[model samples]
Target: MRFLAFLLFIAFVLFAIFARWFFICDILNLCEEAPVEVEVAPRLQTLQLTENDSVLLSGYDQFAFSKGIDQPELNTNNEQFLDTLAQMLTADTTKSLEITGRFTPQEKDIMAGFYENMGLARAAAIRDLMASRGIDENRISLKHAITSDSLLQEPLLFAFALNDLPSEYATASYRFTNMTYSDANFPSNSAIFDPGEAFRNYADSVKVYMEAHPEKSIRIVGHTDNIDSEKYNLKLGMRRAESAKEYLENLGITSAIETESKGETEHVASNDTPEGRQENRRVNFIIE
Candidate 1:
């Protein structure tokens, strides 16, 4: 009887230990940090303008915005950086909008705070900057802003891109919304090829068109099919744009030619079929 009792006691002790260990592990996991989302405030869309076909801006250079950081203020390189930003906003005329420059993923380390708070700082700074410019709080926009390295390709929030700028305006305004300079694919751009004969004609036509009208700026947009990754599409987009730019440059209409790419992000055709993919891989030229 005593031996059976001893055996029962041992079994009970083992079960208790196992139960304690399991619960402890579960508790640890529960204590882990949850995934965080960076939320930006509603942006200002009213003040934006599109001059001609592609370029976007605020009606003037006086306005600016700050980019986002993953971890709130934790990565602040130095307290002086914040002070410098504040000073730039305050002493407007002396500094040419200290564009906190884009976040170029340099090896420079940033102190971590909270990720959400970091984004908040960026938003707050932009608002403060605009308010200082004598612009009403309602007129400023931070919705189009981003902390990524490339402004041209950030598929952020419901923000409108430079494409939303009005094409009818002779000279539109765009503010320095944010910077994403470190993104290897910067603008995640892409392009479609107008190879062979059509390519030559497109090139030649642009040359003639620009030669006839010297006062306008030409915007070359390259698009890519959804057949590949966003990064690959972006490269293809650049190639398409460069092909167009080189074509126009060769024609000697050198004054205002800008190139951009919209890899898979901006697709005109369905990605499911071969024909649609082929159609998606082309470039567009917007002239103003």
Candidate 2:
């Protein structure tokens, strides 16, 4: 029995020496496993406003959304970053934010109520979050883009600008055109001018011209349809012109702006039809 016990002990020792490696390498398969790669998080890029002006948002990555989700999943650091942005906006009243959300074509497009697509909805969601953090909603605009990159790491992009939208209507030579006031342009019988994307281009050109030739001045001639009395139309037209002038001035134009009212006398279209009347109610910007 003692010899049998000694034999068992020998067997146990042999098992521990020989079987241990096989247990780890063959049974567990740990020896065949490859080294896991650590993924580095993407850093948030700086927001460039101009040649000299830029906003550096350190320690924050771009916000990302889940598949088919409009709301972004923001982290604690993201909240802090937004707080800092809100404070910056509060201090500087002349700056605005443009949030552009990007999406892939392969993803299903989901409409979030008024937003036509998930791209726009994502942008609006971020804008609303910023607005909730004390930034004025009006100061924030939303844009969306479709990307072919299905592997886009981060989906949202941000742009900080000088409180003005980039105009696409810039021209080499200046041509004075009608700043139409109608359903398509401004509210009926109101001085409020909601400048379209095209109009913004013209406004930008005006600024460039004023900067290049400081001696040049602008003349805004306001015209109206024959819906109102002559005196009332004249007043309305003058108000329209003044509104345009004020808009240009806010765009950093320092040149003098003279506003006048042509009333219903200069009707480019007939006032008989709705479309013609709409066409007639406009202001012309003449550079002098």
Candidate 3:
């Protein structure tokens, strides 16, 4: 009986020692396992806009409309502007016009639905004028004003710009010729490609494209969100482009590959939203 009691005491002492050691290690975080890396879901790809086609037509002093009326009458001075705009739109059949209206916040509240209706009405009026001038009505797109940073003292401030090629064309071109990938393909704040399936698939696609187009050279352009200083982002962007270029080279692509960094200069979407930021942080390939 005495030997049995001693054994039971020894067992209890060993259990107490282990429990105390485990408690100490847990308190010190020494028993914690390394965090498992979670894979990020692939973002939906969209057709990229052509860089050179974007033009801003604004800052007109003569463009104004009546308070109750949405139809904008171009003054003699503004007629020349309108003529130039119409010429540009008619110059390219693949190009389309995007019209955006601006209104003061106070005016928006005072006029209520008038603010929204006026914007669309003015856009429609512009479309009709352009159509009358021989431009295709189907090529014009109107987007209502969502928000304005400052109040426009003028009757209304409007901007007209050209859209890129149609979505069908752009999408087709992207699938066949260009490969676009986002920052999610890389580790956080790293130029190294993450060991993810999305990145590997992108690499495979690029390898196939290069094999199919031996005569064409590729330009890798990297861009980043407006999260850091321009200089820092520029360097980061270049590193990312270099990383991609290196990956391609390893894939046995012997064609010439050039890398460029635009930093935070050209943003595809507003940086205020998470999705927009994600869209901004991307690398594009231009096959020449």
Candidate 4:
């Protein structure tokens, strides 16, 4: 028995040495291999901007100049355009504006940074003007692109599109007719969904609509009353939205659903009254 034990110990040591020398070191490709050459596609060769039906600022000759928009140089046309944009934005709280700066292909090499900077500056200038005219700054987005089309004489183009929905969805005639649940439907300071029959019916209706229209997307926006700090309210609002999203997902609604928290910033009612505060803590479903 002792001789057998000694032989077993020797076999174990030999196996360990073999493992370290051959299996660990040689069998496993621990050594660095030669680097491989990969083919990469060239960028800036194609123009990504597409022509859309929604045109807010079209053929504005003022933006054609290389210099940024000067406040003094804004002519009657510019002022009228700004006024109309501000009015449109004021009328629709869900609408947002996008400004794109398009540069000619010839100028791409000479003024790459200039085109980008000018695009942002132009959008910022327009946003500032709109803000001065009583439109919120958060309702605007800015982008820059280089277009090979020489026909685009204007350096900047403005388009007004829905904030949450794609342009195609926005133009569709279908409307979401279901009424949203009020704050009373949910438990106090909780995001858990203990749905009554009415709430379940509403969710079913939304699910049916979404299943029929797979292309459409919905945004569940949650709002809270001004009871706590803005940070706490924001988190609570997000939780509420998430709760709604989970409920909808469980209902087999296959369409894309997103959640947003407005906190106490976008209140539907005055926070002074108890009734008003209750009304403020609600969720809104925006179909896109």
For 21-48, candidate 2 gives per-residue lDDT tens digits of 8898989887766889988555454322
Error of model 1, residue 97, in angstroms: 45
* lDDT (10s digit) by residue, model 4, range 1-288: 999999999999999998887765689857566899887322221212222563334443343344323122455666776787788789988877766555556544332211223344455566677789997666766555566756444555677666767431111011134234457557877887666654565677778888788888999888888999999999989899899888888888888889999888877556898966776787777777
Arranged by TM-score, best first = 3, 2, 4, 1
> What's the TM-score of every candidate structure?
0.32, 0.42, 0.42, 0.39
Give me the runs in candidate 1 sitting further than 4 Å from their true place. Answer: 1-195
Total clashing pairs for each candidate: 29, 0, 0, 0
Span of ten consecutive residues with least summed lDDT in model 3: 167-176
Per-candidate local distance difference test:
0.45, 0.69, 0.62, 0.63
Per-residue lDDT of 139-163 in model 1, one digit per residue for the tens?
Answer: 3333222244443122222112232
CA shift at 179, candidate 4, in angstroms? 4.2
Query: Which residue pairs does candidate 2 place in steric collision?
Result: none
The TM-score that candidate 2 achieves is 0.42
Candidate maximizing lDDT: 2
